[model samples]
Target: MADLEAKPPLSPSSTLEKQFEDFRHHLEESESLRERIRAVAREIESVTRLIYSCLLLVHQSRPIPEVLEKVKAQISKLKELFHRLAGILRECPGQYYRYHGDWRSETQTVVSLLGFMHWLETGNLLMHTQVEERLGLKTSEFGLDIEDYLIGICFMSNELPRYVVNQVTAGDYDCPRKVLKFLTDLHAAFRMLNLRNDLLRKKFDGMKYDLRRVEEVYYDVKIRGLTANGDSTRDLGIQGQS
Candidate 1:
């Protein structure tokens, strides 16, 4: 009786084809969305590069206010691109991470550029919230990932050894001391985290080298008895008399 009342199996020719056709359509839509996301990410990366180039003027000891102004001028353009990316991702609700890889590198680079800028302007680490706020990212909708932000910070640290060298050559002898302090504190803060990210862990390791370079610079300055607090005459006079 039970066997007689059982329903028939779905037709392989009709139902299977329909199911596969649905799968095919879904894949096409996802690919289309990914391409759109990639387009926006490319633009964002271009803008990030522009900002990074502008900030490179720092290595030349360019005026902080001027470098910052040039970088800031590009902020609105970045914000608009990010907004467009968010709009595209919104098509797939609750799936931001699904396509995260499509734009992860670009986002990390942008954060590094912005982090470097903020450090130059204020001599402080750019907090994650500040990144979102400055980029005009709606936190509840689309937010900056913590790992990306941390990785960006590591990139920013890579700039410091060169920066310290440049600043010292430019006669800012006291710069190394300040940078050393900051890097030391930053390194300590990183130690507190159990950084499991392979890239982040590697970056954190490189930061040690940055700290060491700054330390050497600071030591050289201190031992030379070079007064870097703008007392140029006294510094020269003491060195000459010695």
Candidate 2:
């Protein structure tokens, strides 16, 4: 009893317990953040596709007022999402937000894209100028004329691969692999959207040509078989077939 009493009671280390609790909290917060990131990433991808669809629709002379409206709405949502993400990030230690890491760069890229999209829709060149001022993007950086915003998509696609590969190899963070996948999916979405836009433009051009040819054929047949009263009566079978 004396020996036992001489020794102090054994208890878990409060420091270790607190450390473990902090670690668990960090893990939970990280997981929640990753989920939010994925949700926003998916939203960004879908909005990108919708924007591309609007571009193609407007290019094809389709009534795209609704699409344009939706693009604007989605862009607004993206801005809100960014704000939320930034808010969460601010809770983190200052290193991440201060460093020129992939997350920071990617967020800025989204801002530039949104700005340019507004410029395209509203014909407000000021939007593009402001984007350049805010993001330090240049017209030559995208390899396109001043009137074109699709060039920004190209710039984004070109830069994504390297950043994704780096994230995959760095292995310092959780969900690096998921981040890579999201970036890749974004690049793919942009490419597909661009291709679809080109195809739709071609299809519209072809349809216009076909309509013109049909009108030409109708006029030629009418001129060849017209009466004085501007009516055709010679070809009952052919006219009926047409």
Candidate 3:
């Protein structure tokens, strides 16, 4: 009772200083996370570039088997890098879309490359599920974005015209007809999407040109009677003359 000393309450200035310190700490942590993400992104870019280079052999008209064999190693490396990216994203939880821009373009390119490769081998569009599976991504936090998948498919469509042209130039005239049918279906499917995304809309617009170019190529091959059976081309010619 003789020693009635009371503890002083925290001053407003001190409280403010404490809050500022916390703010600073948070900013530092966010910056640190950004730096780490950038580092991982650089590694992902390197792996992606390697994978792209391997895939480019297709444009060289290299045998598909040989191209696939060479691309397999890069694909393994890409999957590892993607897993590492997913792990990093896990640390921040709920912030995936924030950093998604960092990797979105590269991911689109990877998807396009893989989609082209799969189409070459299977004559089918690689589904988004298959892409996630190939990349070893979990559907929960690291699923491939639907926009990225669609954009990638558009990019793959752009490749088909060039590929058909190359194949025709290489005397594989059957390629144009097959590619034309595939692109026609793909274009129609894309038209069904209610796309509001400007970039994707632009890409889909380009797909029409791609379809047209392939159709032109198919017609070129048909008019020349270069189809594998020549029967359809001859029939078309007969109809045209009549």
Cα lDDT, all candidates: 0.85, 0.44, 0.82
Worst 10-residue lDDT window for candidate 1 reads: 233-242
lDDT of 3 by residue, 128-171 (tens): 99999999998898999999999999988888888888888887
| lDDT assessment of candidate 1 | 0.85
lDDT of 1 by residue, 174-202 (tens): 78777876787788789899988899999
Query: What's the lDDT for candidate 2?
Result: 0.44
Alpha-carbon TM-score of each model against the true structure: 0.88, 0.37, 0.87
**lDDT (Cα, 0-100) at 93 in candidate 3:** 90
* Worst-scoring 10-residue span by lDDT in model 2: 233-242
Report each candidate's C-alpha RMSD, comma-separated, in the order given. 6.4, 19.8, 4.6
| Superposed Cα deviation of residue 126, candidate 2 (Å) | 6.9
RMSD of 1: 6.4
Candidate maximizing TM-score: 1
Error of 2 at 8 (Å): 6.9
What's the distance in Å from true for residue 189, model 3? 1.4
Top lDDT: which candidate number?
Answer: 1
Q: Cα miss at 193, model 3 (Å)?
A: 1.1
Predicted candidate 2, C-alpha RMSD: 19.8
